[model samples]
Target: MEIDLAGYDGVIVSPGVPLNRHPIAAHARAAGVPVIGDIELFAQARSELPAHKVVGITGTNGKSTTTALIHHILKTAGVPTLMGGNIGLPILSRDPLPEGGVYVLELSSYQIDLTFSLDCDVAVLTNITPDHLDRYDGLEGYAASKARLFAMQSPDHVALVDFQAEADHAVLDMAPDGLGCLFLDDVPVEGQENWPALQGPHNRQNAACAIATCRILGLEDDAIEQGLRTYPGLPHRMERVAEKDGVLFVNDSKATNATATAPALAAYPLIHWILGGRPKTDDLDDCAPHFDHVVAGYTIGEAGPMFARILKDAGKTVTESGTLRQAVRDAAAAAKPGEVVMLSPACASFDQFTDYEARGEAFRAAVEAL
Candidate 1:
């Protein structure tokens, strides 16, 4: 599938394309082709348009939602914006924007790896966690991949950082002193109480990041508030599916790791947690703190038995529901009033389904049948 990029101005590689492990990097470097990501393409293309801006977001979690939110805000304020990068559509596939447009890019570590000359007008790092360790050597290597987002930025650009945890502190410390980085922790999350869809501490941090980014972009205070209030959240991430017979069904299928799923468990008081798939990292140590919220644990997919054993040892009532359909049905039948039947699998979806979206759709269908 290798094509000659000698004639092309720049090679727009897919986010899934692992330049670090793939031959594309060597090919482009040898061909004298500027191997750029979709974000880079969008940033370069925006220069020709009048008053167009670029907002780049990268993190271990919340990257998709934050990018979508930023686009939603700008779009709400009568500014045209396009969202692409790791959240999917290749940036080159779309046409260049006109005046007053903003390009909101959801960047992954892989995409950042390919981009060399991108200087985002507003760059954001939500938070860094140990993810894609196989792609990188270890946690430090993984952290280094995330750091490239800020590292590639120019001194004049703004960096919005969610420095809420120690890991975030480490990433921030790596930045040059007096680099004009804005801390999302300093922003008041107390103000966005009216936005129901953006509840929970995780979303609060996301909101703060978006607010700081928008403010830096010179968005008026009233426009920022309006944008935050009207922004609709992305699906499959803390989405409220349905409420049947006093039981709330939440689809957090996007939580493919323990750290990502931990926030969902913290948001609910009583949860009949539907977890387990092809396991990612070893141990559910990050999720252990939220064990008190689990009323029962419904394990599914290949890792079902392993998860069941772990939950059983933790003294949580566990069921070995091998499939998502079975897990949903069993949880629905056993869940009591005022309990949440949450699908926060804490693992990747490749074991049984193509992706989290397929798993989530199965959960929805199963709930509808019940």
Candidate 2:
């Protein structure tokens, strides 16, 4: 695509467009045109917009939940709020936030790589794990991509790095005068378990991060806890669907990897585990610690046979259900009272469904149909 760049000052591309490999991006660079993402554009326009605060959140997992939680907390605390970036609308596409408004953005690694000028008022890293290995040099390279969020922030801006990583600490130091970093222990959440919508240890950590972010944003104690109790969690991620005669059905289809699935596995006991799809790994070894809790393992989709072999080899009750409908049905049929029929496929849903949301909706529909 050849074009004159004199009329336009810059070009903004989506994060999915790999600038390193995409020819159009190179062409834009060749023309001496500034090429960046929506986030950068937002940053450039900030001076012209109303006075506001921005909270940028990123991680391998929990980005969606944490972003939503922060947005909810800010809203509950009576601060005008808008959400965008990775979870919702593009930042540039939206109008400037109102005075005293806060923009809570769920940024992905790809988005962060494309964004250069977004110095968030409050920047947060949920945690870093080996993910998108195909996109970066290795684990360290991926971690560095997350670190870029802090690097773009002003020294006076607050940084909340929840996950402990010595390497991440060093990289974030690149931020102007090092970041005003905040850790989990700095926040006080006395009875984190009391929040039902946010169950499990991971959510507790997420809660702590949100609590700290809200306090930094000037939220009072009552408002923070109110938001925590009222914050409706994101769909397709540890979503509780239904319960039938004491049997619970959970749809956690967003667990596209083992790390994402571990929390769901830990959240329940006596689970009629429903898992499979296009396999990211050959086995469910990451979930070994929770095997005793899985009353039976029902496999489905492209990875059904592979998961079945692994489960059988591990001396577990394994069934190659081969389809989500069958797996849910089988699990529902086998589950006794007080047991959980959980659909937490720790693999991509592309083999059967369009995406994780579609997969989760199917799981919910199947459970409701029972």
Candidate 3:
């Protein structure tokens, strides 16, 4: 790749690349070249493009499902929409949409960091949790990156944010008055028990955020409900892989953190959970609330032994399966007809596999083998 922005107006670096340490980024900055991201490019192209609205969704978790849900709802309501940016194809790679189409962009903190002026028509925050800590000062700093989605929005835009604690988050309390801001409570979440793809309490919050976005875009309640019911879930994010006899095999390899994996654990009882790769945290403390659901844990990868010890210490049964195939086999054998075999490792897959998708595929293969 070319290091310098020779004839380029700007440079958009990946979030994983720390700009502070990258020489090319520093050089670009010194050369007075704009250093932005996909979101910024999208913002620049908005005026020249067809008449359309933009919905930008960002948070620590649940952003992917929420983004897809909003797109699904809008499309179900007969509004032309495109889903991209951090989830599917790169935003800049897609052709211009027809007039009145909506572009639902799932922005990560990394992408948001590189974005400068993406004033989305609707900015949705699924809820901020402690994540990407090694990249930022702490959770507060990471949260601030997510808050930028709302910060860069226009005055007439809408903000749909979520709550974590009993009280409204002081972090989002300072949301700009110019743009309308609504929390999850403002929108009714009465009937989500029927959404097959969208399960768990975290998804309920995702659904609320999506519903609010659709409503702001002028969709009817019936249409939104239909969208939720008809939406096909994203792969590897709580995806139901297979069912043999009565036991369900769920591939949630996308749950690369405790927060992400916690919901998967809550979705089913008597689970033979397959967790552990390159562990994100020393302990799975965030998943403590759902531990009662796990009948046993099949630990694998670099964190296999570590997790085995942790589970044993907690008075839970665990086995060091050390690989996805073995973990799936053991978990399946251990699971009863009514139980679940879940591959929701609350850790990165780099230790054993190329990425989460590959890890998920391995789980799928193992499940299909049985």
Q: What is the TM-score of each candidate against the true structure?
A: 0.85, 0.91, 0.89
The deviation in Å at residue 221 for candidate 2 is 2.1
Residue pairs with backbone overlap in model 1? none
TM value for model 1: 0.85
- What C-alpha lDDT do the candidate models reach, one value each? 0.82, 0.84, 0.85
lDDT of 2 by residue, 328-370 (tens): 8999999999999988888999999999999999999899888
Off by over 4 Å in 3: 1-8, 28-31, 164-177
Best by lDDT: 3
**Candidate 1, 280-341: lDDT as tens digits:** 87689999998999999999987788888889999999999899999999999999889999
TM-score of model 2 relative to the true fold?
A: 0.91
Instruction: State each candidate's clash count.
Output: 0, 0, 0
Model 3 TM-score is 0.89
Candidate 1 local lDDT, residue 63: 85
Q: Which order, best to worst by TM-score? A: 2, 3, 1
Best candidate according to TM-score: 2
Over the stretch 1-370, how does candidate 3's per-residue lDDT look in tens digits?
Answer: 6565667787776667876577877788777897787778788888999999999988777889999999888888889899988989987888889999999999998898888788889988877766778877787777777877777877788888775621433555445677777877678897877897888887888888898889899998999999999988899998988889899889999999887898988887788999999987898988889999989999999888988888898889998898899998898888889888999999999999999999999999999998
